[model samples]
Target: MMLIEETAVPETALPVAQFKAHLRLGTGFSDDDVQDAVLTSFLRAAIASIEARTGKVLIERIFSWELVAWRTGYGQALPVAPVKAIEDVVLRHMSGSEEIADPAHFRLEKDTHRPRLMPVGTVLPPVPSGGAVVVRFRAGMGAVWGDLPADLGQAVLLLAAHYYEYRADTALGGGCMPFGVTSLIERYRTVRMLGGGVM
Candidate 1:
């Protein structure tokens, strides 16, 4: 299985000013914007890290996920949470043929942590032998920073600040996350059943 981001979060959707305020950086200077680029990068990194840890998307974007088969013939759990819509499902055959599943045949089961793509009927359209299914959809809390839950928004700012503070600290090692950020996102993490099957 492979999940690809069909569209990235727009820079305009990011809260650079809010992040700067969270960091308490100096203002009114002619070069106040000098650090804006750096800050933006950190914010993006923090957002990515938090989202990955929590299986949630803070900003809205399109994604294309390709899989060889459904986890359960009934439906497949989406990789991320709060999916807004299922745009299309395309079946690609090994013989170079493609079949677009009708949107009416399937539905989106919305969940905070483990949304799923379900069939409206008894089963999802079957993929041909040696073929793949590509599911395209939009997932996120919302389009703007304000659309995020308060705790999540705070977590992003806090994590971004952490990155900014440790920008030059090489000894920190990899995958290092602060307790505060982890706590903030813990409730959002999905609880998997046997071998990651959603309960």
Candidate 2:
């Protein structure tokens, strides 16, 4: 669909290698397979989003070629759900043992009238009754546009998860989740601290 200039080739390579190493060590996935999975997952998530809104399969779009190619290159789809799921998890984490009464209360909006992809410090409204939560996520251009470097893809997914968790915890009445972008930064003192390792 959209064309993106390929930048950060050198910057992305090392992190891609590190991401492969992490996946091998943490999940026992071979580097090649992990790459494929990430790409496939990205396509699936993109397709899911497109299908969710348009009720048409992504295969119908001319952009599907780019997505398919990315999937062919990378082994796994990016864990995009965690971007929103982290919010739910964090809410439950902060809410303690109380069961979340309904899933409908918590909603995840992807790319809703947002001009930029991955706008910084955007916060969604909290659901009423302390039970509902809403989150809006922008799909990465690399993932949505074309082949995203592994490192950048990982970073986007991590941020999605981090913000989701952070916002959800903040929405909760009690203390925030022990792990979030802010907490991880304060605790680990590194931006790369909250990688795809957690979810």
Which lDDT value does model 1 have at 135? Answer: 94
lDDT of 1 by residue, 1-199 (tens): 9999989889898899999888888899999999888988998998999988888999999999999988787888888888999999999999989989988888999988788888999988888789999999999999998999999999999999998998889898688899999999999987776565645
- RMSD of candidate 1 to the truth, in angstroms, is 1.2
After best superposition, candidate 1 residue 62: deviation in angstroms? 0.6
RMSD of each: 1.2, 19.6
lDDT of 2 by residue, 62-131 (tens): 1100111111111212223212121221122234333432434333334212111121233222223433
| Residue 154 of model 2, lDDT score | 44
Error of 2 at 51 (Å): 28
- List, in order, the clash count of every candidate structure: 0, 14
lDDT on C-alpha atoms for all candidate structures: 0.89, 0.29
In lDDT terms, how accurate is model 1?
0.89
Best of the candidates, TM-score: 1
Model 1, poorest ten-residue lDDT window? 190-199
Q: What would you estimate as the lDDT of candidate 2?
A: 0.29
